[model samples]
Target: MAEPILKVENLKKYFPVRRGLLGALRGEPQRFVRAVDGVSFEVYKQQVFALVGESGCGKTTTGKLVMKLLEPTDGKIYLEGQDVTELRTKEEIKAYRRRVQMIFQDPFSSMNPRFRIYDILEEPLLIHGIGETRAEREELIYKALEMVKITPPEDYVNRFPHMLSGGQRQRVAIARALILNPTFIVADEPVSMLDVSIRAEILELMKELKEKMGVTYLYITHDLSTARYFADWIAVMYLGRIVEMGPAKEVIDNPLHPYTRALLAAVPEPIPERKDVIKEIPIKGEVPSAVNVPPGCRFHPRCVYFKEGLCDKKEPQLVEYSHNHWVECHLAGKI
Candidate 1:
């Protein structure tokens, strides 16, 4: 098998929940929120591998971990077979940053309100010392902006973030991520903040960029429909664990995990052909706290097919049910 462009193995991030001084003095054991318990996945070159789940399910945390924005409590992140998580030297880390970039969820807040668009896009190149002269830097910035379809870069270059619309600001954000010529990008809900009308355009622009540059994407999102549309492969995460994963169409057309089925049920059906297969809400209850995740199958409490004694007592391991399709549930193949 060809090596993945980016890979994560047993990724874990646990944020300690600090106690009061009195509790500390009492010698209480520290508690930690298991934001990303044990996530494992890979992204092939030029592929959009999406991590989809509801809010607080650790989708965003996983993205941050892959980007090295948050140091992992334990795990390995490899970029082209090199373990970046162990990088120590300043130069090594700098090189890693240049190869990997992020497009944040909010277009409005991700950019600096004070900096001009030119400065924002040029910051990466300047920091990396890529352009020798001012003219060189300006040319690089113009090309990046033009790639994202923000035409006449000169007109927009001097304008501030507040001057651009939500869609245009997001285009700037994409241009910023692309300026460094990154090989991989962790796009955390990049289009969620845009208006419905503009979301398709932004997604299409990203697709074009991927094809043009051969850049791989770790697309983090909560919307299954968007995930299905944007991703080549899909991994459904819950309570920091991947419950199911496979090719995008197979996972969307024939989900096996109850949680995955429930998620698909929640997506509004816009076409008549899918009406017959849309399962009714398969579970009830809000997502459980990550700090105190339920024992056994983390999803049993909310799963419609929860079994007595079994599902609540032992967690299921991820298993392949068909060609390249994997699912984690006791009911796999049986359901």
Candidate 2:
């Protein structure tokens, strides 16, 4: 296999827990929220790799770390085998930004409401010094809009973000990301805010763009259904750790980890024959706080097959169970 376009090794991000003055006076030990605790994944060229879990599972933080928006607490990130953490200077970061971009979840909020669509699209080009003149920039902006299927760019380019529909706005957001022709894009639940009917459309467009432009994606979302459709790989995160990861189809079809099975069981099936056929992988309790993750397996508290000592006394290491399939559970294949 070819080398991965993006690689993250044991990536960690720990945000310090805020302490009030009284607590500070007591000299209590400083605690931290282990948002992204020892996450590691590799995204190949043009592949859509998804990080999926419940809200606050640190998927977004992972995306930000990849995009260089947030600094890592420990570990390394490599872009095309170059250590991304080493690029700290403003010029180096600016150069990296040109090769990497983000497609935010809320398109409207990410855009400047006061700026017209054209200006918004032109911002990246200006920062990167792509086009020498207004005419050249306009041509590139129009081409980007066309690439995103927002044809007749003139019709929408001059309008404000509020004027476009949710789907159209999302297309514009994608267009903005593409304007610089980034090598990797961090799409943070790009379609969660859109209507269900439009979700497939946006995903299809993104997939199409990948084929046409060779852009890889770090797709962050909680929806398993979409991940099954849009991603080539899926990593199930639980309390800042990946519990199961493998090819999208394989993981969805035959989940080894109890947590992965439980997640799949909750997904709504549309076929009449399978409508009530929930797999019923029993899970208990709410997700534990990130500030104090479970001692052993993070999902053991909610897992149905958790063993008393084995699952609670020691953390499980991610191990390969099948062809390219990995699970971090004490009873990965036992269940």
Candidate 3:
């Protein structure tokens, strides 16, 4: 196998809890929200590796950490085998930004309503000092738009973000990221904001672009269905840690962790035979607050199969239960 284009080892990001003045004066112990507590994963060239979980599970924070948008409290991030944390100077970070790009969740919010599509797409090129002349940049912008199937770029480029459909705006956002010819892209819920009918179109376009451009991806999403359809590898995150990870097909079909099983059960089934069947979600309760993650197994409070003494007293290490399938749970293989 080829070497990984991106690698993250024990990635962690903790946001310190801000208590009021009285609480602080009282000498209350400081607390932290473990947004991403010890995530580790890798992505090979042109491979789509997905970080999947429900909202507030740290998947998005992991993507932000990889993009260098946020600093890690403790961990290492390597892009193409280079230590990303070592990039300190503005020039060094600028150079790094050119090689890595991000596609945000909300197209409407991520884009400037004031800027025209051409200017929006041109911003990255300007920042990276790409395409010296306006004509040259125009050509590149049109090419990127064409690549994303936005068509005849001249027509759309002249318009503002509000003038386009939700799908079109997202396509423009994708073009903005691709304009840099980045080595890796962090797509954070790229299709979650689009209409259900158009979600597949956008994903298909992204997959096609990945092969065409030879770019790898760190796809962050909560929808297992999309993850199953679009990603080669899937890592199921829970409260800030990966509970189950493996080949997308294997992890979804033969989930080892109770949390992973519960997630799979929640995915809407389309098969006619199972359409009317009432499926019981295995786990209980909403996701716990990150500030006060449960001890031992962070999921024990919500896990249906949690064993009292063993599950509450000891943390489970992520271990391989099968070939290339890693799970973090006391009863991984047994469950």
Give one clash count per candidate, in the order shown: 0, 0, 0
TM per prediction: 0.96, 0.97, 0.98
Q: What are the per-residue Cα lDDT tens digits for candidate 3 across 87-181?
A: 89999999999999999999999999999999999999888889989999999999999999998888999999999999999999999999999
RMSD of each: 2.2, 1.5, 1.1
Q: What are the per-residue Cα lDDT tens digits for candidate 1 across 1-335?
A: 88999989999999999899999999999999999988888889999999999999999999888887889999999999999899878898889999999999998798888899988988888899999999999999999999999998889999999999999999999999999999999999999999999998999999999999999999999999899889999999999899999999999999999999889989886677665675569889989999899989999999888898999999888889999899999998667
Off by over 4 Å in 2: 271-281
Full-model lDDT for every candidate: 0.92, 0.93, 0.93
Q: In candidate 1, residue 242 scores what lDDT?
A: 96
Q: Write the per-residue lDDT of candidate 2 for residues 1-335, one digit (tens) a residue.
A: 89999989999999999999999999999999999999999999999999999998999999999989999999999999989999989999999999999999999999999999999999998988999999999999999999988989999988999999999999999999998989999999999999999999999999999999999999999999999999999999988889899999999999998888878878876778666664654788899999988888888888877799888999999999889999998887787
Number of the predicted model whose TM-score against the real structure is largest: 3
Question: How do the candidates rank by TM-score, highest first?
Answer: 3, 2, 1
Question: Would you list the clashing residue pairs of candidate 1?
Answer: none
Candidate 2 residue-wise lDDT at 250: 96
